[model samples]
Target: MAAPSSPPARPVRSRTSGPWAKLSTVALWMPFPALLWVGGYAGAEPRLFGLPFFYWYQFLWIFLSSGLTWCAYLHTTPTRPVRTGAHRPADPGEGLR
Candidate 1:
């Protein structure tokens, strides 16, 4: 009888912890609360191009939020290790042994 095959190796998961990690987490999450609270921008004293504060403020954030999200993505992502020829496996068949 043939031996049963083992399960494939799972990919390693990285856990980030540090000041930057916290900052990134906040950057990615802050937009929801800032936009959700209607009272914050419910005003008219400030106007841009004749638009009220509420309308213009939200539009401004639409662009700002995108920038913040990108900043958070950069902070949170891990740098991948470069693979050189010496580190690579010699052949696909080698793993089966």
Candidate 2:
């Protein structure tokens, strides 16, 4: 039996580079610390729809955190290289000929 061929190695990409990357990293990480420091949102004033400030604030963070996470995703996602005609394979009929 023939040995299995190894897969081609992909280039190593740095996800933490660039300004957007920094913003993404912050977006992905800041919520935890911000939420953990409960003193910032511990008050009951400035109610929303009869909800206490503390309760509504935490709820608001849930959506804000999700939006930040999406921003981070957009910023950190790796873009694929566009393929040009040069990289395409010849037609099967041409190959057969």
Give the lowest summed-lDDT range of ten residues in model 2.
Answer: 81-90
TM-score of each: 0.63, 0.64
lDDT of candidate 1 over 7-37, digit per residue (tens): 5544543436688789988888888988899
lDDT of 2 by residue, 1-97 (tens): 3434545555645565789898888788988987898998899899899998999988988999999998888778776544333333356575455
- Backbone clash tally (model 2): 0
Reference-based lDDT, residue 33, model 1 = 89
Candidate 1's TM-score: 0.63
**Global lDDT scores for all candidate models:** 0.77, 0.77
The model with the greatest TM-score is: 2
